[model samples]
Target chain A: MLNIGQHISQEYNDELEDLRNQVLSMGGLVEQQFSDASNALLNGTINIAQRVTELDYQVNAMEVAIDEGCAQIIAKRQPTAIDLRNIFTVIKVVTDLERMGDESEKIAKFASELSADTNSMGFYKNLKHMTFIAKKMLTDALDCYARLDAKKALEVSNMDAEIDAEFEILNRLLSTYLLEDTKNIESILKVTWCARSIERVGDHAKNICEYIVYVVYGKDIRHVIDGKLQDDK
Target chain B: MNNNKVELDQQLSETVGKPLINGTPKITCRDVNVFYNQDSQAIFDVNVDLAKNQILAMIGPSGCGKSTLLRCLNRMNDTIDGCSITGKISLDGEDIYSNDIDPVLLRAKVGMVFQKPNPFPKSIYDNVAYGPRLHGIATNNSELDDVVEESLIKAGLWKETKDRLNKPGTGLSGGQQQRLCIARTIAVRPDVILMDEPTSALDPIATATIEELMHELKSSYTIAVVTHSMQQAARISDRCSYFHLGRLVEVNDTNIVFTNPEHELTENYITGRFG
Candidate 1:
């Protein structure tokens, strides 16, 4: 969004580009982790869940590298103006993205434990719907960040309500399934935990969207966009 | 005042993308321009305000006309053969360029310190006493002595030079000599002090000492400085103005100017992307 490559120092410009590229790739890795965790639950596969666990290391490493890179730029270049806002936004987004990956790993662990019984999951229909919304929200949140588009970021935040609704339906169905049978109690509880983990991932995506609004408009629209819309009326 | 200032302001004024005025202005420059030899323009319709008891810094790359505008404040460029100035520069709402105003009296009211310390060959005591004597500020020898001691203390140089008051001012170290020059400027009790690269020749510690003096001095006098060090401007100035070529690109609070400059040219200069 900044008039790129026009800074007098080419190395400074290159370093900024490297930071963006690292953050985007980190987002890419987290997306894959979420997707794989979802498929492992739907298909009753333990190997995909194990792979999700292994890929967590890459996301964590990217966060560390990007944090160090941001500190270096602040120290050496003392970047200011739009550059300062953008760097701070990147720092915040990386934290949110890393936590999103952590949530996906938690889901994968539960998926591995419930792998054999996933076909008989009473709330599988609702669980699939919730994961689909959460994963789509993550993808679109990162896209809004990459483009610095506040409107698209607000759209991603709006989609989170859908994930929350589906999660509620899954919660109700899990309670009904547990009450109907005592033998499947352990597997049903694991599925409920997975659904809650996916719901939290959607929340993290919404948080990322709030930060996008901040960096783009220099306005902190978090916790107040709904109130502002009310006031506008 | 120029009858067409409204039209000129529309053509020449550029800001920080926000208003930055504070307090009451001591020196107000409006649509001011400077030219040499009637052909080459050094400053182009610059407008700025030096709020009372605040330090305003003018900064840019070399040959950006910062010094030209500084000299215009005290009419220092009047000594040049082919230089001319246009637009209104007022001190407390009184136009400084009026025909009835004497440039010599104006210099005492609006004092200047140069890039290098140019203390006289006379004794340090005389260098500080010279201004008081010219304006007849003191009626007796002891009165002049009191003024000299007070000025040296204000310039942060009295402790270093009190014992050697009778020695030549030029004999001091480079930083001390600059401080001595500042002491001389203060001896006259000017309303505004115009500093042109006042700390360029000093070491870092000496620069810091002068900067500290500037903060202490601002409570009493309106100070304006033209500096090549962008960091120094950020450190000492309440407000900062960035000049490019012959035009003022941006003027704003120092924090905003350094951390969040509005114009592309100002951002480029402060961020070392200068073209």
Candidate 2:
């Protein structure tokens, strides 16, 4: 005979797994869009930019589906404690991914504009560096989710600082280029916008890492002290 | 003057029958069942222990056997011709179903207030004194007056009706009349009190007043109530039993039932999935 308590727990666990899978799928699409937009800027390819734009639609659709799935589970199961945290976190994570998709489209537009300029190599290299860090943070955050590893989530959160630093460097370097040579000002401005988009991607990745902490420990560490993360006891 | 005095003396004797049964459970039910007839089973094999000095709330959906089970607790099901029960139910652990236990006395211990406030069309003092006089909880003119005053005070209706005890109980608002019924029940000093959807008929403010009264009454007497309101159950009950399809789904501490329900059916119901 199946005990009712165990049956309910199993149902809740299954719903959590479904939600986790949806989040991973959404994360995968956002990461791919980030990579494609960066490569388009680096290689001066309009075709890559168009491909990234097309992939944004898929990410948007996945966001809606994941949101509906989370709502259904909450209405049907009424999960509590850790399960409730996981459901709420999935809703927030998917919203962040959807915004990341919008940012990726913005990066793709910047790449298309940069493709038309003569001196694009210097701008491309800076964008590539920013994309590399943002992608790494996103990948690590998703890995933390897959393994349910709070430590890896913390590492991902810490790496966001490096991505922010890269964004600052890109900002200064692009402004210097624009001031020194006004001839290709439009191209430089486009590259700066692309760098800003990548910085936002890093921010979204940091948000996901925060959500992972909430899922594992059931704590809302968002505006609180940083050292509290280590004080899980 | 001679005829009126003779009539008053006769009425007084009918009011006080015998000495009150002291310190005993008003009603006790064990392994009770209620069926629509011989075939349609409503309440399953059930055993309940209702002691004096506590409030128990039975909560579930429309056909979850809560009302049927409440009716059985007070032997109100006896009025239903075909509804029968099995196993032993005792008042103070004495088998109530045995020939020795009178149905009239069983009802005196287990008085009920229903979902809707159904006060009799009589004066407030008359309403409070009706049950005690019938059961002889108090004897003589002065003693019945004291019982009525004390019962209304305990029901929290004395302050509102003390000067107007002679006014009709039905004239009071829905909340007050329900309290009047509670006063009537308390006047008999029953070992247990059965409430069946007592507040469903009242508004939110009235419901709050009744819930507050229930909290106060729990320390002195055992109370068994049936309610369809899940929030009311969560708010007032120390313990709760969830029923579904004539079977008891789960019984646990009130907080556990509301926040961390163990059964999927209970969880689904609480979250508004399927009732």
Candidate 3:
């Protein structure tokens, strides 16, 4: 990976290892929250939806703890170069994970609202497919982080395009559903919100992947897509 | 310009990063190598430039030859038996090791401050006046006094030591003694000043004072400092060179060296991976 965990100071090594593990644990929690929220939306499961919403506080708490840990390490160690990049990346990843948790909670709240609509079964089918791709992207991004694989992270970053295209198709489909009947406009809007939440989750996952590339390769590929840098225009 | 052709003897001459600057360098080391004995070599093929009016910090682990290279700048290693240097080290396009260039005269042009503040056992005023008097820089007693006062003021020691001109330089605090040494070094009006761990023996406040003084000194003199502390190098230097096992591994801007060094060895050392 980046040749971490071999610091001459054993305590420094342990602290960095702990920080990395904490980020992975936070990533796992975020992934679980997103998965549970997606399942609740697709299967009309209110219990899972309620649990996802409740677990968001834990995510928020983990973010605060990780951020404080980063500050403490920075003050005490004054790290530079790769170690500095690693800590900075962790700080950014924690923020993205917390936002993912928030998005998952939003998805869960919308899941409960759309669960009673038996006429909207086809919309859930489309969301299920989109959720499948988004969830895989999240999982692979976290795997890249755990492995410190910048190439894999770049691959995972590119998968966000799939999510975006799916989002566009779903938006078009929901608009068609809105035109089909004015009576179910409210339920269709809820479904659109859920799709948007899932799309946002994909965006946050892509951000995590970008951060992984930064930490491992020391290259900020945030504005680049498919090996091409985006012009500022 | 005399031709002492720099032959490429080894691959270590390919130092990574921006060792060669676009600006005119006041000092340039082309394929420099230092040897302690027949079997023992201290420095490798180091080619780098020290730009004018800038501080270049050379950093590495113990025995990595940063000090050896710094000593070579003023021919300080000539006192040691069997120590030899090869390749061309030039000061303003003049080869420093040439036979016509006397080492004593060369040192007057390039002064040095050591890790410990070794002020003369003389008075504070005399400590700053020693080089000027030795070089016959001041024509009269009043000129000598003015040189002393001006050197002390430039060294940032005038406010505290103005009243204690007759007192021994050793009687000052650790920081003031180093500043007195700096005043002495600058009294000769050297073109370049070399510092070998000049603040290692001082407290943080003293180190900070010396660092600030170095920052000010760079406006008039080309400065090169060999500091074991990476943070000191990062804080004080405009450019940084990383030495590894006598090889000049990398040389770049201070910000790039501290944050995003191009060489893997530089990154390892900066991140505290091995050394």
Best by lDDT: 3
- State the lDDT at A233 in candidate 1: 10
Error of 2 at A126 (Å): 24
DockQ for each model: 0.33, 0.04, 0.37
TM-scores of chain B, in order: 0.93, 0.87, 0.95
Q: What tens digits encode model 1's per-residue C-alpha lDDT throughout B97-130?
A: 9999999999999999899889999999999999
Model 3 / residue A4 / CA error / Å: 1.0
lDDT of 3 by residue, A40-139 (tens): 8887777998888778888899999999999999998889877888899999999999999999999999888878888777887778988998899989
Chain B TM-score of candidate number 3: 0.95
Model 1 complex DockQ against the native: 0.33
Instruction: Tell me the lDDT of candidate 3.
Output: 0.88
Relative to the true structure, candidate 3 reaches a TM of 0.93
* Model 3 C-alpha lDDT per residue in residues B141-243, reported as the tens digit of each score: 9999999999999999999999989999999999999999999999999999999999999999999999999999999999999998999999999999999
Model 2 global lDDT (CA atoms, 0 to 1):
0.76
- Candidate 1, residues A1-233: lDDT per residue as tens digits? 53434577989889888898898999999999999988888777768888887889999999999999999999987776556767888899899999988988988898888877743565777888888889899999999878777677887888888998888887887788789888988988888888889999999899899887665444566787461323221
In order, the candidates keep a fraction of the true contacts of 0.35, 0.02, 0.57
**Each model's lDDT:** 0.84, 0.76, 0.88
